[model samples]
Target: MNTFTETTNTASTWGLYEQMRPQEIEAIQEKTPIAYLPWGAIEYHGNHNPTGLDSIKAFNLCKDLAEKNGGLVFPVVNLAANLIKSYPGVNFPKHSIEFSENLIRLVCEEYLEQLVAQGFKIVVLLSGHAGEPHLTILKTVAEEFNNKYPDKRFWALAEFDILPNDLLVANHSAIGETSLQLFYAPETVDLETLPKDRLITLELDAVSGDDPRLATIALGEQIVTSFVKNGSIIIEELKQKYL
Candidate 1:
C-alpha cells in the first residue's frame, strides 16, 4: 500500500535495520556508513488519525530518505516523547510511564554512542512529534555528540526543520501530518471516524492547525519530496565534513 516505502533499501533481502543481518549491515555500511533514527510518541493524534501517527510518519519518512540517499533506518523510537514541560504536573498518563528530560537525554546519548560503536560514520535523528521540549533535548544531545565525536557527524531535526519555510506547515493531528500519512501509509488514516460536517478542534478532537480535512496525498507527496531532497544534501555534507 505504501508504494514509496515499499521501495528502496529492499534490494536483495537487505532491509531496514530491524530485518538486516550482520553481513547485510556491514555491506551497507561499506557503501554509506550512515544511520537514521526516527522518533515520535504514542500520544493522541485525534479521533480520525491513529495514535501512532507521529512515529509512523517519522519511520516512513526515514525509509524514503534511506531509499533515496542510501542508509539503514533504525527502529522507531516510540517511547521518546514527553509531555510539554510547561504543563509540569499535568500529564495524560502517569509520570512514571513517561520518561523525563534526563532519561530522554541518556537514551539519545546511548543510542548515538552505540550507532558509532556499530561503525556508522554519520548519524541522523529525525523526529515527527515535534514536541518543543523533546525537540530541544534532541538538538542539545546532538550538538554534544558532534562536539565530542570529531571523527563522526551527528545531526538532529524534526521533519520540518530542513524544509523550505513555505512548506513548514507541520503540526499535530492536522493537515500537515495527516496528509503525510495519507501519502506514506493511507491505510492508517481514518477520516470517516470524525463526525460528518463538523469542525475539528484541538480541544474536542485533538486536532490542531488548519483542519485536517484539507489534507491530500498530493500535498503529502510534495512535503515528502522536500524532506528527502534536503536530507540527502545533509548526509552528503556530513560525509564531506566529517568522513
Candidate 2:
C-alpha cells in the first residue's frame, strides 16, 4: 500500500493549479491575472538529497510567492536540460533525466501560449534548474513572446537570478540548495549520508558549496525568508508597473 504523506499544511491548495476550482481561478484572474510557473528536472543531487530537489524547491517557492503576492500557480511540462554532462561547471553523471533543448523550447512555448490564452496579464516563469544555456532559452522565449504580445508580459528567471550573490550563492547541490530543501522538504534530506569532518567538494559528489553538515533548518528558513521577501517585492513591483 502506498500511503501519501502531506508536506505542507497552510491552505494546501491556496495557489496550486491542480487543486484550484474554475471559479476560484477566475476570481483571482479577475483581480490579478498573474501566473507562476515553476520548472525543474529530475537531476541527481548526491545520495543525501533527493533528485527532485530542484522541482520541489521551485514549486514550494511558487506556492509561498503566490500566497504572498497573489497569483495562480501554473503547472509546466516536467522537462529540464543543462545537466552535468553539458554544463561547464560541476558534472556528475548521477541519476538524472535530461531533455533536448529543442523540446525544452517547445514545451516552454506551449505553456506560455496557454497562459496567454487564459488572459494572464503577467506571467512569471521561475526555473529551479539554473544553467546558462537553459535559462537563456527560457528568457529568450519569454522576451520574444513579449514582443509578439504587446498587451501581455512574460518574465523568466532562475531561482538564483533575482537573489543576491552573498545571501544565496548558486551551487549545484551544495549548502544553499541543500538548505533550501531542508527548510521546504526536510524529509528529502539526509545529511548523515555526507561526512561531517571533510569538505564536500564538487569533485567529490557534485556538491559545489560548503559542507552539508553545516546546513541547518534555521539557516534554510533564513534563506527561504530572503527569497520570499525579495520575491514578493519584485512581484509587487511588476504589478504596480504593469497593472
| Each prediction's RMSD to truth | 3.3, 4.4
Worst 10 residues of 1 by lDDT: 88-97
**Residue pairs in candidate 2 whose N, alpha carbon or C atoms collide under 3 angstroms:** none
Cα error, residue 115 of model 1, in Å, equals 1.0
TM-score of candidate 1 against the unseen true structure: 0.88
Model 2: per-residue lDDT, tens digit, 148-205?
9877779897777767887677787888888888887888898889877777777667
What does the lDDT read for residue 185 in candidate 1?
79
Against the unseen true structure, what C-alpha lDDT does each candidate score? 0.77, 0.78
Off by over 4 Å in 1: 5-14, 84-97, 196-198
- Model 1 lDDT on a 0 to 1 scale: 0.77
Q: Write model 1 residue lDDT over 99-175, tens digit each, in one string.
A: 67787888998999999888888888888777767888999999998899888888888888888767756577788
lDDT of 2 at 69: 73
